[model samples]
Target: MKIIRKSDPVNLRRTVDQGTVEQRKIVQSIIQDVKENGDQAVLSYTERFDGVKLVDYKVTSEEFEEAYDSLDGEYVQILKEAADNIRAFHEKQSTKSWFDTQSNGTILGQKITPIDAAGVYVPGGTAAYPSSVFMNIIPAQVAGVERIVMVTPPGKDGKVPAGVLLSAHILGVEDVYKVGGAQAVAALAYGTESIQAVDKITGPGNVFVALAKREVFGDVDIDMIAGPSEIAVLADDTAEAAEVAGDLLSQAEHDARSSSVLVTTSSSLAEQVQSEVEKQLADLPREEIARKSVEDYGMIILCETWDEAVDTINEIAPEHLEIITEDPFQELGKIKHAGAIFLGPYSSEPVGDYFAGPNHVLPTNGTARFSSPLNVDDFVKKSSVISYSAQAMKENADKIARFARLEGLEAHARAVEIRKERWKS
Candidate 1:
């Protein structure tokens, strides 16, 4: 990792919006093919990209049963426990339809309605993430979404991983499809003969999947265009250098472009953390990926003071922020932008990633500055409720007409004028 002093200017915005023009073009072509050709395009792309040919794309009940049987008793039990934890946490975020009545016979409020159906894309290439299934599905369930579909690339044998299938089965999600990459995204956005279209799409995927989501955003609602995972640790002299290093590597191993940063007031602590990162990277299984990530995007930044460190963290707006100072809560009040905050050494980032109740799907690549973490709200739609009695319309119609006329919308003004004339009698 590189050591950067506070004097150097950090351009985090530029680093976050790193997408190739060629990638966008390719993703656009795939989306168009899916929109035009439907299931055939999905099948062809699945074969070409995933190196697998499938007779049927949907996972049958027998497949689910087989997957459940394949897994050990202990792992299945753990998944159930994790699902309960996720459901309980998201249930707190669930909202209800509320209304307010006024003395003048006006009723206004927000009506909360869950999207009819939602699709989640889980990557099946290098790793299998059963945890993602729990995180994505539980929130939608809590929001009262009736139909939840999942899409993932199948292996060369044309079979989804047993763990992935088992996770879906545990959640009672039957519509698991054996398609992935940009094609799966297209299928979710534009309905295929086999896989029905969904109102919204969510989950993490590769660059192709991310670009596909960006392309299909308007056709269907998406969570966010997530980038590479990142973590920033703000430490002081009291922090353990080894623990800080471990937390940085936790995100670094996610991808070659993942950013891991450490901003500290103590120069000695900064040096110690940097050394600890190097020492730990040698033993990691994903050493090559983590090493490249650390060498390129990782940094040990030396700040002159605690305030400077906090300012730098806000500018970065990292996906995950860990404060390992003597008084971590004191520093927490100063943090304004971060997807998830981990306080103290004991509160590691992984706890939120898997077992903890908070949704692991977080905004990445400086997006936390404006967006938010995935929660029950992401699965639901809100409609503004507005009702006015005859007297209330008569009282406010002239003002509404005047406001509409200011915008040169004559028809809008006339509509209000007509209602006002009717109520005046």
Candidate 2:
């Protein structure tokens, strides 16, 4: 990892070009094929990309039973416990429809309604994350979505991972399909004979999937265009070098493009953490990917003061931020932009990633500056409710008509004028 002074210029744009023209062309073609050819196109793309030929794409009851039988009893229990925690946290985020009535006989309110169906995409193959199954689905469930459809790629053997299947089954989500990548996204958005269209799509995937979500955004709502995972550790002399290095590497190992940065006021701590990261990387299973991440994107920034470190972190707006200082909470208010904040030494990034009840699907890139983590709000839509009584219309007709006439919407003025005339009579 490179060590630099705070004065050094850094380009923090995480929205770098993700693919070439050819890759986008292929993704667009896949989307078009899925839209036009439906289930057949989905099957053909599954064979070509995942190298798996499937007779049926949906997960059957027999397969669900097999998934349950394959996992150990203890691991299954853990998954259940995680689901409970996820459900409990999201239930607190559920909202209700409400209305306010005035003495003038006007009713003004907002109605919150869950989307009819939601499609969640989970990546398969070498990267099968059951945790993602919970993070993506539980929110929709909490919001009372009628249907939750899940899509994931099958392995070369044409089977979804037992863990992913088990997680879906545990959550009572039975509508899972063995398809992934841009094709799965297209299927969710446009729908096929086998898979019905969804109101929204949420989850993470590779470059093609991200681009696919971008393309189908207006047709269906998406959580966010997530970029590579990133972490920024703000520490001082009080922070432990080994723990900091371990936490940084946790995100770095996620992808080669992942960035792990350490912003510290103490130069000694910066050097120590850099050395610790090198020592720990040697033993990591994904050493090559993590090493490249550290070498290319990772940095130890030496800030002259704590405020400078906080400013640097806010500027980066990292996906995850860890504060390992004497008083972590003291820095909490200072951090204005971060997808998730992990405080103190014990609060590692993985805790939130796996079991801690909070949604792990977070905003990436610099989007933390504007966007938010996936939540129940992502699966629900709100409609404004307005009811005007005869008396109320008589009281406000002139104001409404004049405002409409100012905008040159004469039809709108006439609509209000007719109501006003009826009320006067």
Off by over 4 Å in 2: 16-18
User: How many residue pairs clash in model 2?
Assistant: 0
> TM-scores, in order shown?
0.96, 0.97
Highest TM-score model number:
2
In model 1, where is the ten-residue run with the lowest total lDDT?
10-19
lDDT tens digits by residue: candidate 2, 292-395: 99999999999987788889999999889999989999889988899999999999999888888889999988889998889999999999999988788888
Query: Which 10 consecutive residues of model 2 have the lowest summed lDDT?
Result: 10-19
lDDT of each: 0.90, 0.91
Evaluate residue 279 in candidate 2 and report its C-alpha lDDT on the 0 to 100 scale: 99
